[model samples]
Target: MTFKGVHRLLLLVFMGLALAGCQTEDTPAKPQFVSTTSDSRNSNYFIEFRSRYALSYGHTYVVFGRTDGSGQMINPEVAGLHPKSTSAVPYVIGHFVPVPAETGWSDGDLEEPYRSASWRVMLSQAEYNKVVRKIRDLQANSKFWQAALYNCNAFTGDVARSMGYSVPPIQLRPQEFVTKLREMNEGRRSVSPSRVLTAS
Candidate 1:
């Protein structure tokens, strides 16, 4: 192809991406997950580890259910640790001291546009209900977010642990945390990471 032809192709690609980004800048994208359970019929329950960009470092959360949509559409349940106030002040303060936290969904969490990585695992009906109960208990008990102590990653780890999954050290960033969780439990069953994270 001529130089002009190549240039035009690249321009079109860039423009298409730009338009797509703008359209989703304020909306949540629907989540599409493929269950790892061999028996798709019996495995209607699932929990997905997800990561997305955030101002401090990044954020990680879980989306659960047999939901067919996201945002307000399917309204799948989500759990993550985040400052109760959306303002940046409390978050910055939390680095040194614990601040109020909310354990449920936050804006953009259900959206795929901001996601960096995802790993999903299927669960049996009994396990699914148990995990949901654990999540709710954690939310009620967890009232603060502290960077060095308890934060989003810690919150996620606690939820995964209830399902008998081996959890990495909570100091790692959100993206790394979810990636490591999946790697540790590769067989769709609770297992261990090849190497544990000793330090951040």
Candidate 2:
């Protein structure tokens, strides 16, 4: 095959890999710690999108932090969206329309065995701050969650877009969402934020 043929074939491969995993979207235990803030070095800011198995479909979330000199993530913060109450009422209603949502760490966020996929990226201080700001805004203003609309994948996509990362379609499972994100941005090692963040 020619070079052009190879390129096109690779693109098709990735597209199929992503679409093949699509089907749906979990809940995890209460988190003991939150926020990527501590006596950590901000010289290197990083954000990681992760997925974990929960119930039938899995869950997606972001864990961001600074690394120590040894490159260990410190004070990792977790954020995501899910129904506010653990009861089946809100979650079931969320499938048809928006319902009360909670934007923070859920169960299995810190568990390795539960994680099915992860995509981590290093960001400039500017990009990191911008992403964090957007995360906060979404967390504060995102009062609803719906399986077909404002679910966990939607939440992570917002954060990714803030960092100028092209977001994949949202109607996918958590692991697929993260995988597609990494596949789509395989060339973007260091990217600028969508726009300069202004204080709000």
Candidate 3:
């Protein structure tokens, strides 16, 4: 009713709008996960921790898939037997690299994940989307991979951490990293072979 009262109300409205804008700017409002499908046969999913000895150091990667046998590797490399390899599976795979060679987190099938320890993880469509989003966010700026700093195993650990799993230290060797994930995955359903797949 009074001029001063009207002025005060206008100020409060301006402040509220400013705060709302800031909140929107600070938040990355991407879809809070992925497709919302509840198909029982397709909903059962798991994360596979894969590793292999390479040039004395070793390599590691992560694979996400369902247990309904819907995903399969097409022309999966037979390891040492192939000069080049790729997968035809619909699963999501993440790879971290070193400099001058596309270093950092990138999406693609790991060339022959020779030995692996895979464990089942129950995730709703939203949770799976969240995990994928986190991986992309973390890997986007991870361009420089250092021996003591960033590497494939480190990438794997970060993905696990993003998904609310306890991860081992990044310094662990590839085999140790897989073992640690397997240990943490204890009691969870597994879609991988009971025996670790070793290179023949």
List lDDT for all candidates, in order.
Answer: 0.68, 0.71, 0.44
Can you give the lDDT of residue 190 in candidate 2?
Answer: 31
For each candidate in turn, the TM-score is 0.72, 0.73, 0.51
lDDT of 1 by residue, 62-105 (tens): 88776443312244689998889979999777765689999989
Give the candidate number with the greatest TM-score: 2
lDDT of 3 at 195: 16
Please name the candidate that would achieve the greatest lDDT relative to the true structure: 2
User: Which runs in model 1 stand beyond 4 Å of their true positions?
Assistant: 1-41, 68-73, 191-200
Write candidate 3's Cα lDDT for 1-200 as tens digits.
Answer: 89999988866664443233123111111111121122223455444555555433345666564544544433322111111123312111111112322323233235434343333344556555676676566555555444344556677777766654567765565656656675664443222223121111
Off by over 4 Å in 2: 1-42, 193-200
**All candidates in order of TM-score, best leading:** 2, 1, 3
TM-score between model 3 and native: 0.51
Cα deviation of 119 in candidate 1 (Å)? 1.2
